[model samples]
Target: MSLPQPVPPSWKDLGKSSSDLLGKDYHFHGAALEVKTQTPSNVAFKVAGSRDSKTDHIHADIEAKWTNKAHGLTFTQAWTTSNVLRNQIEVENQVAKGLKLDLATTLSPEKGHKTAIINSVYKQSGFHTRASLDVFKGPTFTADTVLGRDGFLIGAEAAYNVTEGNITRYAAALGYNAPEYAVTVHGLNNLKTFTASYYHRVSRDVEAGAKAVYDSKSTHGGVALEVGTKAQLDSSAFVKAKINNSGVVALGYTQTLRPGVKASFGVALDTQKLNDPSPVGPSHKVGVSFVFDS
Candidate 1:
């Protein structure tokens, strides 16, 4: 359901074209606190929080997830409790806790409430199917099916909004996949989005990709080009870089620190305003992250 479309512009984004803002900005911070855990038997939990220095504000959340994969059956459930500290978005402060509650939290018309969603997937030989439903003020249901083997695949998805009393959106995708290269094309019926991506493995430890996306119903329409590469430096370290034609460049590095700890750092720069005499605001950011496991 190519949902979350027609996104509102960023706080102070300077992109002249509507397509420039088609994608949401990745949330990055100079520092933050995070913790994660997983059990041997399909259970996991996470608690994370961070503050915005300039705003003197904090956002925090706790989430728990468990999946059952025994007896040829797959079922999963997740629950979250969030404290959206900012008053910027009325709903965020009121009912946006546990953000991943799916259609209820994601697309339900009703705002500021607890959300619950369930999903189950079934697979056999050359086919797989998934069904999901969310409990917000009203239930929204989604179903998707795919048929494919090792070399090729195709799928379609449809979602129904019970609260809105109508079918919300539909999507279809086709792709070809192999060990060395892959390509895919997909579109959303609701948002007028067309996206295609291609990837190729240059060797065992290096791969590159290019993606093109066009969407809009606003500002006429726009397109973006992104190219990226990831390469393994050794057994426990790697680096990644991406350049977007619109105006940004980013690079990241990750390394394992110990048996169960990992660290990462990244930076993103807006190339367009880097040399401008009258810059609107901060044009770059650096972020640090750490993960620990039992």
Candidate 2:
């Protein structure tokens, strides 16, 4: 129950805050087609009967992006089978314009035949900032000691934005994980997380937000709070809603079926009470996307 930290846009002037802090030169490519169905009041790893199962899933993604005025790069590759996990590849890079550097990596052998790697580097000069980290190790057996026991993770995120509309943004991030990592082979491991968020913009096509999250695991330590709203229905239609940290509720929609095509749909409902509990389910997804520019 941890996913909330994306809500920052509310400009009151200065040509909408210099077109939202100048930076543009974009490229996009996309693909998605999905099918999912599940009904469970109780089900965990075999022995079925509470009746409900319909699964057929397919996913494909392709991305290429570039940002000028300094440095920015993005590359993505994704594939999915069904009942979770099929194939995956991810790549991310960001340079000085975003701070110092950023990196990400993931290779999946259908979820458990795993591979993961994460690296982050950041340094700032106005209000102070710093980050240096590493993650994920183990599995890919015998490719010369499988690159020496893989799973390892480290984290950092420091913040200070007393005023910038980029609006009064504040930040704090912490991370740690290592226990012969393969995400501890599904039982995850000694992990920790702390997050904070805020954004304000109550006009111009209405926008509102809120966030707070804390997680510590090796069994459980949880805290979650989220509030969201984003509306812009004229340039192409959009909507969002979220509620997490166990008392699940999510709704999403996006539409722009012309100038390069677009379509999206999302729905989720779950009322949590752990110990192999994630039922009382309702999940739906639909996506049709396309973007190409040269």
Candidate 3:
């Protein structure tokens, strides 16, 4: 019998549980639509468009991907109305077991700018590591690793700027994950900022989470906190709400229109200035999005 492979959190995912619960799918100033389709030739296509409330401009993007599951290879291409094109190629478990490689390049035709990055990830029992290098723009290098055992995780990351000959960024994280709850603490931006997050599944239909941040470099050097909750109203609908220390409240509701269609609505309001005459004081926003998969 073979033992199960240990799963460790990626550097960017150290506080993903609470982060996702608090930040995901809560839009305040945009209306968007997306369509996704799968083709018989092992290809997938996605088209998305959005109208930005602030800019009053419509933006769109088209993306396509071809995947070969047998060989663990994937290729993706994307183009946006902003005159930028991106290409990505990924290989998994081919160079070595438990290893993955990714190469991505982006081109901005109008701006005549191009950039490329190479990344590699390796995972094994009780450990996970990854590294990336920018082929352009100072040829910076970044690496992160995590060690995990019994749901306890510790991870650290660092980045070096080749041109500057210095370490530009460093961060560390500690986390505990359980079947019903997860908690994480991170020292980020060279330990000048600290964050702690917690997530709990109260029941099958209810979930709650919170996040707090203390930034020593902030102008006020104060702690900021936000708490959020998600609840399934029924089989076809769900709702989420969150409030921050600044008296800003946001709420979102999502419903399944049918088997392949879904819609989401969200709003944000400032509680402190609900009756203020000025628009800057009584700020409010609304957003809506629709998705179709076929």
Candidate 4:
């Protein structure tokens, strides 16, 4: 069998600024008008530079997505390109009819990064197994299997990161899963960075989680903690919020207005960035989003 092509570089800044977190379920076709203010998100929307964005980076982009479902197979692709604004493209294809497999690819041309991931799942007589391989500038391989009935599951996985025929990082995890809660511990960079996280379903409509991170490396400034919660307002609406010890808070919400139509709002504030107070005030962002499932 032949393997898939390699991926481009992936970065956080390339994915977040003026982001659209819409999932595919309807035929969406609509554009968003960002009402910018003196906010950090607004500043990030400007001209794309090499590994950093230029000031006054505000611009407009037209994003359109199309999805097709048929014969137990589904395919979806979206593109956002512009000479005046930033460019992003996404493509996804999943086959879940008889055989079970999924392939997702994301590329950022301007940022010079791409990623392709292939996932395969198998279930038989209450035993579940999943295998995944990711291709980027480097390859990451992981395989997981669990045994149980109902929602209770226990599993372990081993992962390896390779670069130039050398092992850069090796990691393993032990996890338990239930209907309402999950726990896992992960170590990375040969235990240079360690993390443990727990998540639980507090109620039918509310879920909460917390994470603890420890860095053996001195450059990370030691330990950090994060807590977050997600709430579903109704069939078509939801809200999420999270905060970290660094005095950073992020809030986001989404609501479906009508059939095949959705809208959203988000804001993020960081107190650490507010030191020395520039004319734009503390680094903050306030924006709106829209998605039309036509």
Whole-model lDDT per candidate? 0.60, 0.34, 0.92, 0.53
Backbone steric clashes in candidate 1, count:
2
lDDT of 2: 0.34
Model 4: per-residue lDDT, tens digit, 128-165? 56666788745877665555444334444555565556
Better of 3 and 4 by TM-score: 3
Root-mean-square deviation of Cα positions for candidate 4 versus the true structure, in angstroms: 11.1
Reference-based TM-score, model 2: 0.22
How do these models rank on TM-score, best leading? 3, 1, 4, 2
lDDT of 2 by residue, 50-112 (tens): 111223323333222232323343333333333222222222234344343434444554455
Predicted candidate 3 versus true structure: per-residue lDDT over 9-98, tens digit per residue: 787888788999999878667899999999999999999999977778999999999999999999999999998999999999999999
lDDT of 1 by residue, 198-288 (tens): 7777898987787888886647567878877878899988887778987888777878888778887767778987985533236776667
Best by TM-score: 3
What's the lDDT for candidate 3? 0.92
TM-score of each: 0.70, 0.22, 0.96, 0.56
Give the per-residue Cα lDDT of candidate 2 at 152: 27
Where does candidate 1 have its weakest 10-residue lDDT segment?
85-94
Off by over 4 Å in 4: 1-166, 271-282
